[model samples]
Target: MALILLADVGSTWTKLTAVDSNGSIVGQASAPTTVGTDIMEGFNSALSEIRGQTGSKEYSIYACSSAAGGLGMIACGLVPELTGQAAKLAVLGAGAKVLQVYGYNLNEDDLKEIDDLRPDILLLAGGTDGGNKKILLENTQALADKVSPLPIVLAGNRNAIHQGSEILSRAGFSVEVTSNVMPELNRLDIEPAREAIRNLFMSHIVKAKGMETLSRRLAAPLIPTPAAVLAAGKLLAQEMGELLLVDIGGATTDVYSYGGIETPAGMVRKGIVPPWDMRTVEADIGMRYSLQSLVEQAGRENILAQAPHQEQWRQELDKILTYPNRLVSPGLEGLEIIIAQWAVRISVQRHAGSMERVYTPAGATDVLSGKDLRGMNTVIGVGGVMVNSPDPKGILTMDSKGLLPEKPRLMLDSKYIMAAAGLLAGSEPRVARRMLAESLAAL
Candidate 1:
């Protein structure tokens, strides 16, 4: 029987799934991601194990990577609400983590911080098609003088693109110019920027990570793991309808929503209307790497209220904070669950749109801001915490703000095949859809 190999090389682990041509998941394995050396070392180690289970050597290999800490990016725009947010959305959609999003010109301190962060790409976006050009000009000049030759994606005002691109290119920075992210106020044109970032990831970031060696072995070009997940979410939404996917990871929690939204009867939407397909990454909230930040956001008192043994849990929390990767004992898994609960709570709250009362001349009118996921009837949970937890569904049912589906069906990505299925979605829709249905049905 013909076989296919799908893999996701994550920061901490390299997971692989083997599936027959019939779309049956045959075997799976993983190893520590050795991006410190050659990434292929970990991949080979995992492949060796999979070989023992499936005894397959000749299979079509498809892979994506979140290794080398994924793609880090800094976005500069003219205004925080308009251009800045547009830039951020474009970066997130392209599967890059926004290290920082700066509005107006880049100051000395901002440049220094950018140096420290050492992002893979710098997305310079601001103004509209023919709007303010001064900020883009100033930021480009500052970047040329202060920043290293990191790739810069210029998606700002049409009036500034030529000058900005010239400034950066002359400074030895590789520049890709695309249409403005915000062509007009409240009108986002981010797809071109997103495509530019993805192309840079393939051309530049992959080489920087020394993934070129492994890229040659894949059936197709490598894609960012988060992008794969987002693709999978979109594909699944096509068949299953509108849904919200919450992916909790070691360092961040990413939420993706698909399908059109309906505004409440009398409520008016304020600010930018989020895309029908949208993704928001909560960098501060996570179970492991960002545990400290998660605790700080959830508050110690709030977290302790859920703990049966507060003092004991404090000591465990300290250890998890320090090591971040330390394995949790069976007895202490409850703490992880509690942490996961908060992670889900805080993340979904941020992901879901909110409404507030605004007194108008006529009467009190409600204004809604952000994506309204209330119409969603499905919530899919991925990540180690949810997959390993005994009560994964229970964790998602705690809708603190009534923003989630009123009574939703909760599904867990137990095999963590979302990314893998995503890698196949573009080329093998039948296989991808079957994999998604099978995995979700397993729950």
Candidate 2:
């Protein structure tokens, strides 16, 4: 029998899971992640504690993801609207947040704003199919001048790759050039850029953060928290065939959707990859850290719109934001229900919007047309609030309202450890699949 150890190093918590040869979970554990501390130290301590309990000398595999340090990025564009949106999409796709965006008309103030952000990586893009090259080149030059030693990804016009690289190199800045995100006005090509961003993340961002010290200590490279989630999503998509998984965390809600293809029986499975038919939406609608974003998106009107009896919900939400650690008050049961409902709505809508953009061909009319999204086969719900609701009926509430598919299976990250399981699954597909099967069975 073989054993595997998995860990998901999140911004707020580190979740650990131990699985046996048959893919049954043996033990689960969690620990608070020391935000500013060396990630390796925290990871090692958690690993030690898990191993101590299991008394396992050797494990078959180990994997991890991190959200603590903040996955930062700078987005560049030719036109503020088209390429700009494309650039934003690329950053979001990579599971990182955009700290800044620079476009053709962006002035010195914009550049300064970018500098102030101190992003982990910069994604530069611009121009329509074969439009302006000078604009992209000039923006690249300006970016290079203001920020040196920062890794830059040029995902602009395909015709300008060489010229873009030359300008950045001459300025002594490291640059990686990829395919045009907006090759044509109507079509967006972002895979090449997404790949380049991940590569640069390994080469530049990790090292710059003093994470290199920890990298040498660990057996594998550390992954950004969102990337790990994305990796798990890709694996699930391949295995489950067009599935939607939503993980609501303390700081953000991550939605990963797979709309095509099942993993072949013989091929080895690993983390999510580009070109895989999938979409992700990360909303600030978290239970704690980013509750404000959820409130803003859900709005008092919308939240209260559904629950007329929850007049104090807004006050509770405000109070929760101020003191995140407090437990949900008994009187606010309806408010919690409303918040969960609203979060599900916003998160699912965002997920579906991205899927529609990617899967829906222009001018095509099908019953699943933007109107019939409810027909999607599977929707997997994760996170503490959804999993540990005092009322089991809450899960049913999501199902009834179409927030979760009626046929969906709800799996709680009971240990808050799916990320780690996901990372481990990347290397051991059979074990991952087995664990997933068992998880669903238990659910």
Candidate 3:
């Protein structure tokens, strides 16, 4: 008979659900997010209305995820190729929208590009462990000197920590330092930086968005939309044995997989693991927002590279980039199918790359061997882009060809905000598990 409130505050909408003990959604509501205004007031108003309808049962937990006020970030690296890629991976992993990336070789115009974007967080990472400290340090110094005092996460050479911290602090910038993302030429350790990034979001980014005004009124910390997704993914995986979740949003496409488990001591009762058994990847390929990034990655040449008509393919991509959020018209119907297919393919590939990197530790022989395409049991798809499409056939086309690995049984998210359910699952496993099952059934 327990009732739990789950909410996902997206950039455009705030979705809320009230789930009963048996995992049935007893109540649900949606509202436009009051960006740049007091979020708490809007949230409270929404919750009050839901509570009134559902009956005032004591809520066991209040869980949330947010993408409001833009979780924008800029990534800086020593080498444009290596660390830049790593920085992008980490940024995506943390669930923030990366506005731009800069490397040491980036010229004045590059710096200007980042400055113009006015990102909330700057992720600066470079150099392998005990590798070139000079390049990372110099880049950090240059960025500190040029950029306004934004929250900077230094996840580069471990040796450069004290010096980089001092330099950033001297420049009056708030800085958090973590382990080298590229600890070795062949290995990348992104957990520390990922954690620091999430903390920064809670401490600085949310505050900047004026979410703190609302968060202060709440009991728990205001978590970024992506972090909450990660949290929920972890719980789902642990509870259901193993799981894969795909979130295709308007701005980015994210894939999260959770496999294996080692239950913690105190957390045995409450299913919160100190570290997640989950791996996440975010591709800036949404129906809107970073639609251009999707096009760039898939490449006009690569996507059209195989097309029977090159000019037509190019023209369609242009149209998609121009009107990313527009519905597929009769004329461009085929083209929309092509674009969605390519976007899903590229997005899934990126997700696989992140999963392989995170799950397979350095020199681990039997890595991801048991669970490849053949072993995956379930794949859940979330977000409006996937669930709310007019043509189930078009959605199924992507699911069959683009979104999932070959072997898994695919399901759509009947409730769009599973992350919120996941967060509560940490505290109330039985209730959360039931709700998740109900959600799966509804889908």
TM-score of each: 0.94, 0.81, 0.75
Global lDDT of each candidate: 0.86, 0.65, 0.65
What is candidate 3's lDDT per residue for 1-443, written digit by digit as tens?
55767767767677778877666778887776766675555566677888888986576555455555457788887776677767776776676767787777556787677678778888888788788888777866776778777888899988887798889889988999888777776355678888898788777765334466556644465666776777666666665555667777666677666653332232211111212233434446766678788777767576676556677767766776788666654554555555555666666555542112232454432223111322346667766766665442344333433223555656766766577666565566676667667666322
Write the number of the candidate with greater lDDT, choosing between 1 and 2.
Answer: 1
lDDT of 2 by residue, 123-201 (tens): 8888865787888888877776875557788888877867888988888878888888888773567878878887877
Which runs in model 1 stand beyond 4 Å of their true positions? 207-210, 400-402
**Which order, best to worst by TM-score?**
1, 2, 3
Error of 1 at 379 (Å): 0.5
Angstrom error at residue 166, model 3: 0.9
Q: Per-residue CA lDDT of candidate 1, range 330-352, in tens? A: 69877888888889888888888
As for candidate 2, its clashing pairs are 78-126, 231-272, 238-263, 270-426
* Ranked candidates (lDDT, high to low): 1, 2, 3
lDDT score of residue 136 within candidate 1: 94
Angstrom error of the Cα, residue 12, model 2: value is: 1.6
**How well does model 1 score by local distance difference test?**
0.86
Candidate with top lDDT is 1
Error at 305, model 2, angstroms:
6.9
